[model samples]
Target: MDMKLEVVILPVSDVDRAKDFYAGRLGWRLDADFPIEDGYRIVQVTPPGSACSVIFGEGLTGQQAGTLHGLQLTVTDIVKAQEELASCGVEVSGPFRDETGAFHHAGDARRVPGAHPERASYGTFAAFEDPDGNAWFLQEVTERAPGR
Candidate 1:
């Protein structure tokens, strides 16, 4: 059995606003935007060079917008990424470095995993939230290990 992640459903109260935030502000590529029955709209956006995309729309059962938390998007440069997002008015949490020579969420500076003397295995990262209050993280990592 094999499984691969493809999409993440981000619940939102307003589809168009979310679209503007992700696509217009964040510079994600808008892949799809159409309507489904029951007056719901399906909108999908993918980060540049990313394998997984985020899906958000209406008519989802028991789903409320702005409830997502702890989603991470890894990149190659934390400072550059933070600058880009800040340029677009996104509030970035930090570019703080830990004792392990890695930068991570300043909020978690004191509580790194395993005392590995290195940043999180994923690399340097930061945190931010969308207009809908959906929390997200940006990680800066080197190239993946072979066979990963």
Candidate 2:
């Protein structure tokens, strides 16, 4: 039995604003945006080349907006990804690496200034946030680890 992760629910304060950030600013593909009934709506967006999608809107999740973190996306080039996001008017912070190799990323204490010395796969990363402050990390993964 193969179970696949399909979608992640995002708690957002405003539906249109979040839509603009995800679909307009970040350039993710807008899969759906439908109002179910009164005070209820659902919007789905998928990052390019990703199998999983993200859903956000009204009356869906109990989690507070701007409180979710640790959502990550994989990229082949950290620098390029950061540049692309900055070009899209998104505030990006990185091209940095974990210095201790322990991945302790609670704050900036364990973070180094730049990418890994050898540009190692999964060694470097970048980050950005949505309009609702949902944090997303861009991990540089040049090659898949053992069967992906």
Candidate 3:
């Protein structure tokens, strides 16, 4: 059995604002926007070149807005990715590599000043957030592990 991950539901306080941030600021494609009964709604957006999508809307998730953290997006060029997002008015963090050349922490203490010198896969990252403060990270991956 092969199971492929699909949609992730983001809990957001304001539906319209989240929509604007993802679809406008982050440049994700708006896959769907429709209404459910009793003022509920469903909005789905897909990041470019990603098979998975994220959804947020009224009454869609029971989790608190701004609580989700450490969601990741992979990029090939860390510098270009940071520049593009910053140009779109998003507050992206500067690219940083882990001190140990391994996984980084969700907090600020482990950050080094620049991308990995070797440019190894999964070694460098920058972070940002949605309007409701759900954090997301951009990781630079120049090579995939076997079978990836």
Compare the candidates by lDDT and give the number of the best one: 3
Candidates in order have lDDT scores of 0.77, 0.88, 0.90
Check candidate 3 and list the clashing pairs: none
TM-score of each: 0.80, 0.95, 0.96
lDDT of 2 by residue, 13-106 (tens): 9999999999998899999999999899999999999999999999999999988888889999898888889999999888788877635386
Q: Tell me how far candidate 3 lies from the true structure as C-alpha RMSD in angstroms.
A: 1.0
- Give the clashing residue pairs of candidate 1, or none: none
Off by over 4 Å in 1: 97-121
Q: 11, model 2: CA deviation in Å?
A: 0.9
Q: Please provide, for model 3 over 1-148, each residue's C-alpha lDDT reduced to its tens digit, 9 standing for 90 to 100.
A: 9899898899999999999999987789999999887669999999999999999999887899999998989999989999999898989886998788898886767799888888888899999988899999899998998999
